[model samples]
Target: MKYDKKEPETMDADPMRLLVSAILAFTVMLFINGFVGSMGGFPAFVAFTLVFFRIRTRAGMGNGGMQQELSDRQITGRLLWKYAAGYLVLWGILRIAFLISRVTGWGNINGASAVEYVRQMWNTSLLEKWAYFFAGMIMFAFVLSLFPLAVIREKVRWIRYALVDGAVFALVCLGNNGVCRLKFEQKSSGGATCLIDHLLLCGRMRTWQEITCLLAMVVFILVIGAFVFSYASRQYAVKNIDGIPASAGEEESRRHRMIRKIVTVGCSIAAIVIVVVIVLLMPKDTAGDYTKVAEFLTEDTRMGPMEYGDVVYVSVNEEADLEKNGIAQGYLAERGERCDSRFYQLAIANLLYTDPTGKTNLVQTAGTDGGTYAPVASVETDKTWETDDVFLLWDEDWALESAYSHEPTGYVACPADLIQGLRMQFPDVTYRTADFSDYDAYFTLRGYQNMEQALEEDPVDGDWVGCILVKDNKFYFGSYENQITGICLQQLRKVLGGNAK
Candidate 1:
């Protein structure tokens, strides 16, 4: 019997309803895939591939409607290629978005005043961008709504087109979260500035290993699954098509199949090469020291093995600043949680006690105040060693430039008793401060510039004031802008024991 253009009136299933159901099912599947990722152990690539194959197999069987048989001769390489290429492009866009989010604090609503932008985009008001997105999705569905009608009449390629487009739409929706996070960072205080500082001063990326592993897994799974699904769908179709199509339809289908196979082969090779290049380029220096530090810090075992140096100039309270700016707060709000605050005063106090000149009274006042100091000019020393670990620790207000240039280097200040306990532990360590005047001479001789000059002249923040230097038969804190307090000396002594002093 010849197939009719329209279905018989008794047909129970409404094509439009089936189309809506398919769209809704795919959307639900995409949401579930994301939820599975959050639960851990389930790979998104695998989940998506399984969903796609299930759709293809069901479509091939005609959802138990009119039976069809596919032909092996009709399943040309071109069709597989087209299908794979479409999926690959969709995957690429999603990957790029995910990368942006991971690097830039995107979609992390808790980060850097991100909530405002998120709220703006997703608010319930009709004017919100989210409403626009929904409208767009509706228009897209309307235009593609004819896909189910095509599938019902066995115009199989429309089903393929619809699936590819829907998959892309889903991936893009997921990736927009990352893009939103990027928007948040650009708007907030210390957002881009903090990013640039981390780039220049922080030196290396921390999550390189995990990134390499994830990329490797994703590429491997996508390639293997794409090929398997393509070949299986073609075989299933060839087995199922019962009625011969018009000469034109058959010719078109053959040409399409050949193109898809070619695309698949090209895509598989490209995916492999891209994955290899990314893995090879991954950063490998896991624990490289970004700063050079004092002698009292050791590389031995009682404490965890030592990391080489400090990462930046100021150990500012990053968490406090982030919270102030409305960045997402993490476990910090929990009571009694110890924060790894960069105690600059502890280092400053160590410098004070070690200062060769007894007149280094700048260190005494720091003990009474919270571990903060302010910019001070020294009449005794020609110029403050801006990079040294000394700052007036009492000032509630401090800026990044001040700490970078004006502060002196010493132990991060802690309670006085902590110092005494450390001294008792490491009695032999000879921790002492250098003369403030000598620090000026040293910086001049070494061709060093202060923090402000450095920031203005050299954008790299390369011009540091002082370091915990160890020369032949010489061991001492060399920078004098800030004096190392007795408090820091004690902590160092305790850490290094007799050998460090």
Candidate 2:
């Protein structure tokens, strides 16, 4: 077919493709970088942007003439080899940086975070990190090079592309190879996957509303089919006898026109119904409705095991059934909102538990010896524990026997066992317990004598002590050897829960 001079050589560019590519690339990179312990995520974003532009340009060329004759294997192979070399070269530089850190004691490099592969280092060579970062970008570009090939070879590339895409997509979505392993076998380590597994367990099945929406969608699809079929049938009939013009065919033509008009009216109504049904099928977002910490705690049967160290943490509240408990201690309680420790405990617990629905798994406790620490604001208190029952809290008015040199009101709370353990395991600091009748006495003893004085002191100056809330009760513990954060607390809570706490 010859094209008219007025016709454009190619169709307009599809912005939709670019947008989709960008979103998919970002989501994949974020997940991979978070789980792979590589700083390649940002680079992957860069690679996707470049590839999107390149693809859009190539798309304008269309699959005609010479392009159509090219073999899929040859096209894909050339593209893959070209970008792979670029990516590897970049990765090579990052590898060198990693090797240097392993040998040198100068740079303070922290390993991968829970979410990304990028190592966080303080006082380290920024240039080196950047080198590795760029390498990740190159790798992503190489991966995306095959996107075009997959699209063009859709019929034959199902198995090939599906395998490749599945691996990449799973890794990107789940964060780590561990997750991917669980996805395929449903028995890797334990359970299906980590976060996804727990999410599925917590999430509800399709409700009646969702089912109704799905039914509506089916109806809409059926209507669309019926309308399209009728419209097409009318057009087909007209086309078959469209040119005949005579008295004999005149009556037939009139009859066909009336039928076509009726079909057109029916099609229009069906089209409107389809659109309305589709709109109704869309899902809506809603806010989370979780109870507050204090409220959740006071509820009956809230007691849960929290295994930390060698002992399990049992609830110390009077309401809890404490008949067989061996120890008990009370720590000043902080406001529910200020207690960030419990959230961290939950996050880590999800990571540690192979079966989140209270299944057994043997995971080593990091204990006081194993932890990532950073300076933070906290309280101080001391108490002896004869039983496993423990209570942790922060009193706004609680004061110490001696003032925390840097701050007026700081306290630590733990049962006698933990205090003794801390002393035996980590003996540099002194530990003492304070008994305050109420918040006011607690602050007065700590030297914060007044709330005004407490406000003047820096919150982060002292050793890190904080509350870790399990299912209902709070356990107050102190660490002198390392710092504890909300993240570590969550992991500890999960492990401790295994011991029937």
Candidate 3:
């Protein structure tokens, strides 16, 4: 039974209902976006999705539409798939916008040229472009609106609707996209300098940027004006209560069985994979948080693999600065927390009692665990260093670059009391700082430019370098922190204590 294409049949569903719902949904969505940020738009989007799809697919089926042939449950099942597809489309739009910004180095003060920028960022990470998340909802609403009308006899007509909806969405998104903003480090004379006040930083744009910005603005205006024209001309939005073109006619399908089977198998595979991933990610709550400080104390732990404790020391500077390497975080590791911070000040303060030139001032550090710090081991020892436990230091210390570095290093300004209790508990093996002149001949030097610069610049942040031990008799040198294990530390303490047994 073929229906003639007079005005293509109709349903009692309110034609203006979609427009009203869209205005309300998008208004609420955009308003809430400011409070919750871009991510918060998801729930608002889903809410809008559910509301809009319910109309063409199920709610209006009662008056006269093809969807009336299915039960509410069947209609709901179909609507959910439509909702999911629409979500993917919206997500893709946002991802593409974010990709453009990422590839172009948007908002980065240190942005390089496009080619170098893309090369550097290609392997890095993709961050969200919030404009799509915020303004893209208008386009997404129109996309969702098209899904229920997929079965219309004039199927090609949906393409026209999509084109219009997409134009509106894209235009709205342009105002917020990175293209509309200034990115380079160039000084802005002021937005008022441009005919338009700082829209996409017209005052700061190079010739090309200006051309692109103006072109986009012109296109956006034209497209938006076109929408107003289409609406005014009754070619869009103004509609008759026509036949069931929007899910208007019920039809049978020979491929229904095959499609259902495929969907079931696909869902089953997805469910199993999801369950496995979730189980694998579940934390082992029963595991204890014991950390052996000896584990990571190596020039390179990879040389002789250590099961290295759960205490991975991240950089305090690194945690603060995303660009720098994270080697300095050892100063603040708590005892039981994952990523233990310790050893910088504790080791430095342990140096000499009277040298007077050390850079470290024992500042009370707050632990990552949100607790007051205390020194776990004291540097005070009446015992003389008759054994002469000498150590070579680096700021990785600015002292490593000084003339005094060639002389016997002495500790200065050590704290009588220390912070977060310096979590590392070393055996009583007394030691003193010594210059690297002791091993300049034997050591292989390969510190990076950034590391060396950072080291020479800051004296207090000496955690960057490992402590090299010199036996002093014949230039026999080794790293104290890297080479010494828990087992070796215990043996040295016994031999030093004269309890060889």
Q: All candidates' lDDT scores?
A: 0.31, 0.33, 0.33
Q: What's the lDDT for candidate 2? A: 0.33
Residue 155 lDDT, candidate 3, scale 0-100: 30
Worst 10 residues of 2 by lDDT: 435-444
How do the residues 1-501 of candidate 1 rate in per-residue lDDT, one tens digit apiece? 233354333222445534544554455344333311111112224333433333333433332232443333223232343334443444455655654564468654335344543443354332222223332332222222222322233344434444444444334433433333443343221211111111222222335643563465356445544544454444433333332333434555777878977765555555445435533543332111111132112211111011112111111111121212221211111111111211111111111111234333221111112111111112113323233332111111123334566653211223334433433443333222323212221111111233343233322222112233333323244332233345565443443342334
Per-prediction TM-score to the true structure, in the order listed: 0.24, 0.27, 0.27
lDDT of 1 at 378: 24
Cα shift from native, residue 229, model 1 (Å): 6.2
lDDT of 1: 0.31
Please give the distance, in angstroms, between residue 311's alpha carbon in candidate 3 and its true position after superposition. 2.2
Query: For candidate 1, what is the total of clashing residue pairs?
Result: 70
